[model samples]
Target: MHDALLSALSTVNDPELHRDLVSLGMIERAELLSGVAHVKVNLTTPACPLKGRIEADVRAAVLEVPGVQDVQVTFGATVRQAAQPALPGVKHVVLIGSGKGGVGKSSVAVNLAASLARDGARVGLLDADVYGPSVAHMMGQGAARVTANEQRKMQPIEAHGLRFLSMANLSPAGQALVWRGPMLHSAIQQFIKDAAWGELDYLIVDLPPGTGDVQLSLTQTVQVTGAVIVTTPQDVALIDAARAIDMFRKASVPVLGIVENMSYFVAPDTGHTYDLFGRGGSRKLGEQYPLLGEVPLNVEVRQDADQGIPAVLAHPETAAAQALIQVARNLAGQVSVRALSQSLADLPDQLTVV
Candidate 1:
């Protein structure tokens, strides 16, 4: 009966959450004795909007099993803790960063994380852009605080099958975060060190634009697997992007690849593509560094961003999504290593200043 009850939980899915309660780690414990069932589950948020539905499904699943006389269901909320020992299984920690703002780094990070999650990889995204942490908004999660589990470990908010941590989760809605350098860096460090990111295949950190103190601090502290530079295909953007790459190179963090955002715009009425942001800047920069892929400007991608649904998940068949997925797959292939030894091996033989 216990085994059957557990199996039934595998069938109960969280509709809005879009993950099986079992896979979401919602079912903490289950016991059956003398045809009676006892179960405990953890929820992602306090006042979960789906509490009633989730409870109903749990009861139904356990009762449907044969020889179940009485079923006991328990629910609890997750909280944030100070810290936990690191999980050694996290393979890659990719930083999706850029030198200038408005290059769509967060969009690339969010979509890429979703794409990687779809490919059966355990992915996590840390919104390191303290001033503009848009990952929570992009992922459709309202302002909420993270929780800590029984082991006193910080529990990350789950959305689209990927675990996430961001300053937006901590700040109140509609309020501007006016924090200083030391405080911002400390908060970023806490989000990285304190959160319980278990066995992640890739942990993508969306960094703030330019080579600021936060960027320097992260590269110094965390073992950044590599960094993907996001830039628009324009002369000015390329100049700043090159400076960003130089910063990473000086720090000895290998440039995994470069992704050009808003590379081109395609008109809806006619099958014509316009070079809105100029042409070949990204390609020229790619020639300077390791080029990954370029994502064109698409209405569908913009629409998905507006609705908090990543284009990779909302419209996986689109060309833009495909391009993002390819970049993600490429990033996933990189091996994880510490120190500057293996990472700096791929630096351009001759550094070019833009």
Candidate 2:
């Protein structure tokens, strides 16, 4: 009976990871008592959305065994950490920022990471928005707990083919973060120096709105590759976005490009286009820096974000997703070009023969 129960449980798999629970070390123990089987399952995170589904699958599978009149399923979580060496193998770190709040910076960062992953790049997302961390909920790992490895480094939570770390994952939900400048600086340092982010082709950082201590601390702490400023195609947003560009310039970090989000909206019923926020704002900003791309205002983007899935993955055929993909490609191309230029410049000039 126990063998049958184990086999039955083996058939259940984690929906996201697509691996059987038994092999992943999720099934802790199982026993039969008084015609009722008691089982314990361990999860990767507390905030896993598929908990109910996993529980149902386990219960139903166990009941199929002979002599099992009832089944008792319990769940526990043990979050594991990855190794964090001093020299993390991340090729490029891109910071995504906005001048003001509610400009969809986090959404852009998430979709950019997803798009890069889709293009076969190993990506990592760092939610640097301490005051308003949203990556945990956006990536569907809000209830997930982070654990430390033997080296005592916090492991990034994995989701949507990207490894992510966020303040929301560390603290309790709805808790106010009243941290001062020094505390915020220390936290940012810890996130960069102590977190186990392994090897990644790109590390996308979602900065908190405005040029605050967190942004300053990050620029001072790490050698950022560049920054992408996100803004709506409105006067207020563009004004703030200009400040963001200036902030990156002062920090000596290159402004990779400007992404004009919510550029326009198209009526689904009438198929009519509307410049809801006005147009050509990003193009004007592009005169100072490259314009990565403009993303149209779409309801599906909001729906996907709320559902904890990136639009590119949730609705690949949508215009918003394709626009994001083009941005990713352009960003990747820029990074490559800059790397090559730097490499060439670093080469020692050959001695001229007289």
Candidate 3:
């Protein structure tokens, strides 16, 4: 019965952690007596957002086990503010961010997650863009809510084999967060520390645009492995991207590389290409730092994001998807720096410190 319970738990995942509850070391205790089974699950935070779903999953898994007649599922949590994986192996934490909105930061994050998942790597995405969480919309989990364990810690929502979290998961659509920096910091802190993010090869955090309080708070709280800057080919956008790089550098966070979005437009009818936002800005930025790749202004990319299926998953063979895949591969290779390094460029004596 013990083995049976463990087997069933293999299918039950801690949504935020993105790993099987059993494998994540979240299943604290499980037993079967006279065909009645009781299980206790643990979480990482006091106000975990995923308690309900955890109980339901535990109940479902135990009931499916043979000799389990009645199932009582309970939850618990670790006292640690941030729960690292039980194992001490290295797991990369990548922050996908931008200095300006409409640059497809979330789209890049989702597509990158899907692309990495396609390559068989364990991946998780966090919609840290508190003021504008769209990972739910992009990943098709917008209506999905996180469940908590008995301790009331949050459980991530799963979709397409990727575990995800977003403010949208906690509240209904169109509801304002009405949260300030400290509140945002606490919420994000719990999201990282209290939620059980398990044995992941890559944990992608989709941050809000600009170098704001949330981004600053994240750098101070979570030991981010790296960062990815998203921008367009426009000069104005590049200027902001530079500022973002400076901020990350100030915080001692490494920048993996830069991704240029809406780089160009290709005419569907005549097979002609247009540099919609002008060209060379990304190349110039890449010259200063490392340039990952440029994503074209493809309609399918936008459509896929709106449809809750990343372009990489929805159209793997398309040019847009192929380009994103290459970017993902490059990003996967960038493990040495934490995103700040790659994006930083030495400024003139006067502007250097700022």
The estimated TM-scores of all candidates read 0.70, 0.73, 0.70
* Candidate 2 lDDT by residue in tens digits, 75-190: 87543222221136776778999999988999999999999887667789999999999998889899998889889999999999889999998999999999999999999998
Segments in model 1 whose C-alpha atoms lie over 4 Å from true places? 1-87, 334-354
Candidate 1 — worst ten consecutive residues by lDDT sum?
Answer: 78-87
Candidate No. with top TM-score: 2
Off by over 4 Å in 3: 1-90, 336-354
* lDDT score, candidate 2, position 301: 94
The per-model lDDT (C-alpha) reads 0.76, 0.83, 0.77
Evaluate candidate 3 by giving its C-alpha RMSD to the native, one decimal.
Answer: 15.9
lDDT of 3 by residue, 1-354 (tens): 677787787788766545566655567778898888978876543223456777888888789887788998876544221123322332667789888898888899999888877766667888999988899999987778889977776887878777888988888899888888899999888888777666666788999999999999988886777689999989899999998999999988778899998888889899898998987687776876778888888999999888889999888887778889888866765542222122223212121100
Query: What's the count of clashing pairs in each model shown?
Result: 5, 2, 30
- After superposition of all CA atoms, the RMSD between model 2 and the true structure is 16.3
Q: Give the per-residue lDDT of model 1 (tens digit) for 165-265.
A: 88788878767888888887788778777778887767889999998978888876677667899999988998999899999999988787789888887
